[model samples]
Target: MLHYFFKIYLKLTGWKATGPVPKDLKKFIMVVGPHTSSSDVFMGFAFRSVLKLKHIKFIAKQELFKPPFGFLFRQAGGVPVDRFNKNNFVDQVAEMFIQNESFAIALSPEGTRKKVDRLRTGFYHIAKKANVPIVMLAFDFEHKEFRFAPLFFTTDDEAADYNKILTFFTSVKGKNPELGLEHLLN
Candidate 1:
Protein backbone atom coordinates (compact mmCIF):
# COMPACT_ATOMS: atom_id res chain seq x y z
CA MET A 1 0.00 0.00 0.00
CA LEU A 2 2.68 2.51 1.00
CA HIS A 3 4.79 1.62 -1.99
CA TYR A 4 2.06 2.41 -4.45
CA PHE A 5 1.11 5.55 -2.52
CA PHE A 6 4.68 6.83 -2.60
CA LYS A 7 5.08 5.87 -6.24
CA ILE A 8 1.90 7.76 -7.08
CA TYR A 9 3.11 10.74 -5.06
CA LEU A 10 6.29 10.90 -7.13
CA LYS A 11 4.30 10.92 -10.35
CA LEU A 12 1.97 13.62 -9.02
CA THR A 13 4.99 15.80 -8.28
CA GLY A 14 6.32 15.41 -11.82
CA TRP A 15 9.36 13.54 -10.55
CA LYS A 16 10.44 10.29 -12.13
CA ALA A 17 13.59 8.23 -11.94
CA THR A 18 15.46 8.30 -15.25
CA GLY A 19 16.43 4.63 -15.47
CA PRO A 20 16.39 1.36 -13.61
CA VAL A 21 18.45 1.63 -10.43
CA PRO A 22 21.10 -1.07 -10.51
CA LYS A 23 19.79 -4.13 -8.68
CA ASP A 24 22.16 -6.91 -9.70
CA LEU A 25 24.78 -5.51 -7.33
CA LYS A 26 23.54 -6.29 -3.85
CA LYS A 27 26.03 -4.41 -1.70
CA PHE A 28 27.33 -0.93 -2.61
CA ILE A 29 27.41 2.70 -1.50
CA MET A 30 25.01 5.07 -3.20
CA VAL A 31 26.19 8.68 -3.51
CA VAL A 32 23.51 11.35 -3.93
CA GLY A 33 25.03 14.75 -4.58
CA PRO A 34 24.09 18.44 -3.98
CA HIS A 35 21.83 17.74 -1.03
CA THR A 36 20.71 21.34 -0.55
CA SER A 37 17.32 20.80 1.04
CA SER A 38 15.59 18.72 3.69
CA SER A 39 13.16 17.54 1.04
CA ASP A 40 15.89 15.37 -0.37
CA VAL A 41 15.01 12.63 2.07
CA PHE A 42 11.36 12.64 1.09
CA MET A 43 12.37 12.74 -2.53
CA GLY A 44 14.62 9.78 -1.98
CA PHE A 45 11.86 7.85 -0.28
CA ALA A 46 9.52 8.51 -3.14
CA PHE A 47 12.23 7.60 -5.61
CA ARG A 48 12.88 4.35 -3.77
CA SER A 49 9.24 3.46 -3.80
CA VAL A 50 8.95 4.34 -7.44
CA LEU A 51 11.94 2.20 -8.17
CA LYS A 52 10.69 -0.49 -5.77
CA LEU A 53 13.86 -0.50 -3.70
CA LYS A 54 13.39 -1.63 -0.11
CA HIS A 55 16.82 -2.62 1.17
CA ILE A 56 18.80 0.62 0.86
CA LYS A 57 19.63 2.11 4.25
CA PHE A 58 20.41 5.67 5.25
CA ILE A 59 22.50 7.22 8.01
CA ALA A 60 21.02 9.95 10.17
CA LYS A 61 21.90 11.73 13.40
CA GLN A 62 21.33 9.72 16.56
CA GLU A 63 19.01 12.37 17.90
CA LEU A 64 16.55 11.73 15.13
CA PHE A 65 16.04 8.21 16.46
CA LYS A 66 14.62 9.48 19.75
CA PRO A 67 10.85 9.72 19.53
CA PRO A 68 7.69 9.35 17.44
CA PHE A 69 9.17 9.69 14.00
CA GLY A 70 12.18 7.59 14.93
CA PHE A 71 10.37 4.33 14.48
CA LEU A 72 9.21 5.37 11.05
CA PHE A 73 12.71 6.32 10.02
CA ARG A 74 14.18 3.12 11.37
CA GLN A 75 11.58 1.04 9.57
CA ALA A 76 12.79 2.76 6.44
CA GLY A 77 16.33 1.57 7.11
CA GLY A 78 17.69 4.62 8.94
CA VAL A 79 20.93 4.06 10.81
CA PRO A 80 21.70 6.38 13.69
CA VAL A 81 25.05 8.09 14.14
CA ASP A 82 26.43 9.85 17.20
CA ARG A 83 28.27 12.78 15.69
CA PHE A 84 29.86 13.72 19.03
CA ASN A 85 31.62 10.38 19.05
CA LYS A 86 33.26 10.40 15.69
CA ASN A 87 35.68 7.59 16.42
CA ASN A 88 35.80 5.05 13.62
CA PHE A 89 32.54 6.22 11.99
CA VAL A 90 33.73 5.10 8.61
CA ASP A 91 34.73 1.78 10.13
CA GLN A 92 31.33 1.50 11.77
CA VAL A 93 29.56 2.13 8.48
CA ALA A 94 31.82 -0.26 6.68
CA GLU A 95 31.10 -2.78 9.39
CA MET A 96 27.39 -2.50 8.63
CA PHE A 97 28.13 -3.61 5.10
CA ILE A 98 30.53 -6.26 6.30
CA GLN A 99 28.07 -7.78 8.72
CA ASN A 100 25.06 -7.70 6.47
CA GLU A 101 24.65 -10.31 3.74
CA SER A 102 23.43 -7.50 1.46
CA PHE A 103 23.33 -3.77 2.16
CA ALA A 104 23.41 -0.45 0.35
CA ILE A 105 23.77 2.96 1.97
CA ALA A 106 22.78 6.30 0.46
CA LEU A 107 24.39 9.55 1.54
CA SER A 108 25.41 12.90 0.17
CA PRO A 109 29.04 13.38 -0.78
CA GLU A 110 28.76 17.06 0.12
CA GLY A 111 28.02 15.97 3.73
CA THR A 112 25.64 18.91 4.18
CA ARG A 113 22.87 20.82 2.49
CA LYS A 114 25.17 23.72 1.78
CA LYS A 115 27.74 24.76 -0.77
CA VAL A 116 30.89 22.71 -1.05
CA ASP A 117 33.89 22.83 -3.31
CA ARG A 118 35.12 19.31 -2.66
CA LEU A 119 33.37 16.12 -1.60
CA ARG A 120 33.91 14.74 1.89
CA THR A 121 35.67 11.61 0.52
CA GLY A 122 34.37 9.57 3.43
CA PHE A 123 31.99 7.73 1.12
CA TYR A 124 34.84 6.91 -1.21
CA HIS A 125 36.96 5.55 1.59
CA ILE A 126 34.02 3.55 2.92
CA ALA A 127 33.43 1.97 -0.49
CA LYS A 128 37.12 1.19 -0.85
CA LYS A 129 37.32 -0.36 2.59
CA ALA A 130 34.13 -2.34 2.06
CA ASN A 131 35.32 -3.47 -1.37
CA VAL A 132 32.14 -2.21 -3.06
CA PRO A 133 31.50 0.11 -5.95
CA ILE A 134 30.06 3.58 -5.47
CA VAL A 135 26.71 4.12 -7.18
CA MET A 136 26.34 7.79 -8.15
CA LEU A 137 22.94 9.48 -8.24
CA ALA A 138 22.30 13.11 -9.08
CA PHE A 139 19.44 15.32 -7.91
CA ASP A 140 19.27 17.45 -10.99
CA PHE A 141 16.87 20.18 -9.92
CA GLU A 142 17.61 22.10 -13.10
CA HIS A 143 16.23 19.30 -15.21
CA LYS A 144 13.75 18.34 -12.51
CA GLU A 145 15.02 14.80 -12.72
CA PHE A 146 17.10 12.35 -10.78
CA ARG A 147 19.91 10.89 -12.88
CA PHE A 148 22.00 7.88 -12.06
CA ALA A 149 25.56 7.80 -13.28
CA PRO A 150 27.88 4.88 -13.81
CA LEU A 151 29.18 3.05 -10.78
CA PHE A 152 32.65 4.15 -9.65
CA PHE A 153 35.25 1.61 -8.71
CA THR A 154 38.25 3.04 -6.94
CA THR A 155 41.62 2.41 -8.48
CA ASP A 156 44.98 2.70 -6.74
CA ASP A 157 45.09 6.25 -8.09
CA GLU A 158 42.51 7.89 -5.80
CA ALA A 159 42.87 11.27 -7.45
CA ALA A 160 42.11 9.90 -10.87
CA ASP A 161 39.09 7.96 -9.60
CA TYR A 162 37.70 10.95 -7.75
CA ASN A 163 38.23 13.16 -10.78
CA LYS A 164 36.38 10.74 -13.02
CA ILE A 165 33.37 10.48 -10.67
CA LEU A 166 33.31 14.23 -9.98
CA THR A 167 33.06 14.94 -13.68
CA PHE A 168 29.70 13.13 -13.85
CA PHE A 169 28.18 15.80 -11.55
CA THR A 170 29.49 18.82 -13.41
CA SER A 171 26.22 19.71 -15.13
CA VAL A 172 23.88 18.62 -12.38
CA LYS A 173 22.03 21.47 -10.69
CA GLY A 174 20.99 20.97 -7.11
CA LYS A 175 18.18 22.55 -5.10
CA ASN A 176 20.55 25.42 -4.45
CA PRO A 177 22.62 25.60 -7.58
CA GLU A 178 24.37 28.75 -6.39
CA LEU A 179 25.78 26.85 -3.44
CA GLY A 180 27.44 24.20 -5.60
CA LEU A 181 31.17 24.18 -6.20
CA GLU A 182 31.95 26.49 -9.07
CA HIS A 183 35.25 24.79 -9.73
CA LEU A 184 33.57 21.41 -9.72
CA LEU A 185 30.67 22.50 -11.90
CA ASN A 186 32.97 24.37 -14.28
Candidate 2:
Protein backbone atom coordinates (compact mmCIF):
# COMPACT_ATOMS: atom_id res chain seq x y z
CA MET A 1 0.00 0.00 0.00
CA LEU A 2 1.01 3.67 -0.36
CA HIS A 3 1.09 3.94 3.39
CA TYR A 4 3.81 1.34 3.75
CA PHE A 5 5.80 2.87 0.91
CA PHE A 6 5.57 6.31 2.52
CA LYS A 7 6.67 4.90 5.83
CA ILE A 8 9.71 3.42 4.16
CA TYR A 9 10.38 6.72 2.42
CA LEU A 10 10.24 8.64 5.68
CA LYS A 11 12.57 6.20 7.35
CA LEU A 12 15.04 6.35 4.48
CA THR A 13 14.96 10.15 4.56
CA GLY A 14 15.84 10.24 8.28
CA TRP A 15 12.48 11.66 9.29
CA LYS A 16 10.71 10.01 12.21
CA ALA A 17 7.17 10.58 13.46
CA THR A 18 6.42 11.04 17.15
CA GLY A 19 3.09 11.53 18.90
CA PRO A 20 0.27 9.82 20.66
CA VAL A 21 -1.89 7.64 18.45
CA PRO A 22 -5.49 8.05 19.45
CA LYS A 23 -7.70 4.97 19.42
CA ASP A 24 -10.60 6.94 17.96
CA LEU A 25 -9.54 9.98 15.95
CA LYS A 26 -12.50 9.60 13.68
CA LYS A 27 -14.09 13.03 13.78
CA PHE A 28 -11.52 15.71 14.48
CA ILE A 29 -9.77 18.70 12.95
CA MET A 30 -6.06 18.25 12.33
CA VAL A 31 -4.54 21.72 12.40
CA VAL A 32 -1.27 21.38 10.48
CA GLY A 33 0.98 24.41 10.85
CA PRO A 34 4.02 26.03 9.20
CA HIS A 35 2.94 25.10 5.69
CA THR A 36 5.66 27.06 3.94
CA SER A 37 6.47 25.00 0.85
CA SER A 38 5.02 22.66 -1.75
CA SER A 39 7.11 20.03 -0.02
CA ASP A 40 4.69 20.29 2.88
CA VAL A 41 2.15 18.39 0.79
CA PHE A 42 4.40 15.39 0.27
CA MET A 43 5.65 15.54 3.82
CA GLY A 44 2.14 15.71 5.22
CA PHE A 45 1.04 12.79 3.07
CA ALA A 46 3.95 10.71 4.19
CA PHE A 47 3.35 11.66 7.79
CA ARG A 48 -0.31 10.66 7.68
CA SER A 49 0.39 7.50 5.77
CA VAL A 50 3.12 6.51 8.15
CA LEU A 51 0.75 7.10 11.04
CA LYS A 52 -1.85 4.97 9.29
CA LEU A 53 -4.58 7.46 9.97
CA LYS A 54 -7.97 6.46 8.65
CA HIS A 55 -10.29 8.75 6.75
CA ILE A 56 -7.90 11.67 7.10
CA LYS A 57 -8.91 14.35 4.63
CA PHE A 58 -7.87 17.78 3.48
CA ILE A 59 -10.31 20.34 2.14
CA ALA A 60 -8.50 21.75 -0.85
CA LYS A 61 -9.52 24.10 -3.64
CA GLN A 62 -11.40 22.51 -6.52
CA GLU A 63 -8.67 23.62 -8.92
CA LEU A 64 -6.24 21.13 -7.36
CA PHE A 65 -8.50 18.34 -8.52
CA LYS A 66 -7.50 18.92 -12.14
CA PRO A 67 -4.69 17.36 -14.18
CA PRO A 68 -2.52 14.28 -13.73
CA PHE A 69 -2.36 14.26 -9.93
CA GLY A 70 -6.09 14.57 -9.40
CA PHE A 71 -6.47 10.83 -8.94
CA LEU A 72 -3.65 10.78 -6.44
CA PHE A 73 -5.18 13.65 -4.53
CA ARG A 74 -8.51 11.91 -4.30
CA GLN A 75 -6.80 8.73 -3.20
CA ALA A 76 -5.26 10.77 -0.40
CA GLY A 77 -8.73 11.93 0.71
CA GLY A 78 -8.56 15.40 -0.74
CA VAL A 79 -12.02 16.98 -0.58
CA PRO A 80 -12.34 19.56 -3.28
CA VAL A 81 -14.16 22.80 -2.40
CA ASP A 82 -14.95 25.93 -4.37
CA ARG A 83 -12.70 28.37 -2.50
CA PHE A 84 -13.57 31.26 -4.79
CA ASN A 85 -17.28 31.05 -4.19
CA LYS A 86 -18.82 32.69 -1.15
CA ASN A 87 -19.99 29.52 0.48
CA ASN A 88 -19.84 28.46 4.11
CA PHE A 89 -16.74 26.28 3.86
CA VAL A 90 -16.62 25.52 7.56
CA ASP A 91 -20.23 24.37 7.61
CA GLN A 92 -19.65 22.37 4.44
CA VAL A 93 -16.70 20.56 6.08
CA ALA A 94 -18.57 20.15 9.34
CA GLU A 95 -21.29 18.45 7.35
CA MET A 96 -18.74 15.97 6.07
CA PHE A 97 -18.10 14.91 9.66
CA ILE A 98 -21.81 14.54 10.24
CA GLN A 99 -22.30 12.47 7.11
CA ASN A 100 -19.32 10.19 7.43
CA GLU A 101 -18.99 7.46 10.00
CA SER A 102 -15.48 8.71 10.54
CA PHE A 103 -13.75 11.84 9.19
CA ALA A 104 -10.63 13.83 9.96
CA ILE A 105 -9.79 17.02 8.07
CA ALA A 106 -6.22 18.28 8.01
CA LEU A 107 -5.99 22.02 7.39
CA SER A 108 -3.37 24.74 7.65
CA PRO A 109 -3.97 27.58 10.06
CA GLU A 110 -1.80 29.84 7.93
CA GLY A 111 -4.11 29.11 4.93
CA THR A 112 -1.19 29.67 2.50
CA ARG A 113 2.58 29.31 2.23
CA LYS A 114 3.21 33.03 2.20
CA LYS A 115 4.10 34.84 5.40
CA VAL A 116 1.13 36.02 7.44
CA ASP A 117 0.54 38.35 10.35
CA ARG A 118 -1.41 35.65 12.17
CA LEU A 119 -2.97 32.31 11.55
CA ARG A 120 -6.62 32.11 10.53
CA THR A 121 -8.86 30.74 13.29
CA GLY A 122 -11.10 28.66 11.01
CA PHE A 123 -9.49 25.42 12.12
CA TYR A 124 -10.33 26.07 15.75
CA HIS A 125 -13.85 27.22 14.93
CA ILE A 126 -14.46 24.16 12.77
CA ALA A 127 -13.44 21.80 15.56
CA LYS A 128 -15.41 23.72 18.15
CA LYS A 129 -18.56 24.02 16.07
CA ALA A 130 -18.36 20.40 14.98
CA ASN A 131 -17.73 19.23 18.55
CA VAL A 132 -14.42 17.61 17.73
CA PRO A 133 -10.89 17.92 19.01
CA ILE A 134 -8.05 19.76 17.29
CA VAL A 135 -4.90 17.76 16.73
CA MET A 136 -1.96 20.10 16.43
CA LEU A 137 0.59 18.79 13.91
CA ALA A 138 3.88 20.58 13.42
CA PHE A 139 6.66 20.13 10.87
CA ASP A 140 9.80 21.01 12.77
CA PHE A 141 12.32 21.25 9.97
CA GLU A 142 14.94 22.46 12.40
CA HIS A 143 14.77 19.23 14.32
CA LYS A 144 14.10 17.22 11.17
CA GLU A 145 11.04 15.73 12.78
CA PHE A 146 7.26 15.74 12.75
CA ARG A 147 5.57 16.39 16.08
CA PHE A 148 1.99 16.13 17.24
CA ALA A 149 0.73 17.79 20.36
CA PRO A 150 -1.68 16.15 22.72
CA LEU A 151 -5.28 16.19 21.56
CA PHE A 152 -6.86 19.62 22.17
CA PHE A 153 -10.50 20.39 22.77
CA THR A 154 -11.57 23.98 23.13
CA THR A 155 -13.31 25.20 26.26
CA ASP A 156 -15.52 28.26 26.68
CA ASP A 157 -12.56 30.64 26.42
CA GLU A 158 -11.14 30.78 22.88
CA ALA A 159 -8.24 32.98 23.96
CA ALA A 160 -7.01 30.45 26.49
CA ASP A 161 -7.17 27.63 23.99
CA TYR A 162 -5.46 29.71 21.32
CA ASN A 163 -2.63 30.59 23.68
CA LYS A 164 -2.17 26.94 24.58
CA ILE A 165 -1.99 26.03 20.92
CA LEU A 166 0.55 28.77 20.26
CA THR A 167 2.79 27.49 23.05
CA PHE A 168 3.08 24.11 21.37
CA PHE A 169 4.22 25.71 18.12
CA THR A 170 6.85 27.88 19.79
CA SER A 171 9.70 25.50 19.00
CA VAL A 172 8.43 24.34 15.64
CA LYS A 173 10.52 25.09 12.58
CA GLY A 174 9.11 25.05 9.09
CA LYS A 175 10.87 24.37 5.82
CA ASN A 176 10.85 28.10 5.24
CA PRO A 177 11.84 29.30 8.67
CA GLU A 178 11.80 32.95 7.74
CA LEU A 179 8.17 32.74 6.77
CA GLY A 180 6.97 30.76 9.77
CA LEU A 181 5.29 32.65 12.56
CA GLU A 182 7.15 35.90 12.85
CA HIS A 183 3.96 37.11 14.53
CA LEU A 184 1.47 34.28 14.91
CA LEU A 185 -1.17 36.43 16.60
CA ASN A 186 -0.98 39.70 14.78
lDDT (CA) per prediction: 0.81, 0.81
Worst 10 residues of 1 by lDDT: 177-186
Clashing pairs in 1: none
Residue 123, candidate 2: C-alpha displacement in angstroms: 1.2
Task: For candidate 1, write residues 3-116 as lDDT tens digits.
Answer: 889877767777766754777779999988768787888888877777867778899888999887889779988999777775677888888889998999898888888777
C-alpha TM-score for every candidate:
0.88, 0.88
lDDT over C-alpha atoms for residue 76 of model 1: 86
How many residue pairs clash in model 1? Answer: 0
What is the lDDT for 132 in model 2?
A: 91
Model 1 RMSD vs true structure: 2.1
TM-score of decoy 1? 0.88
- lDDT of prediction 2: 0.81
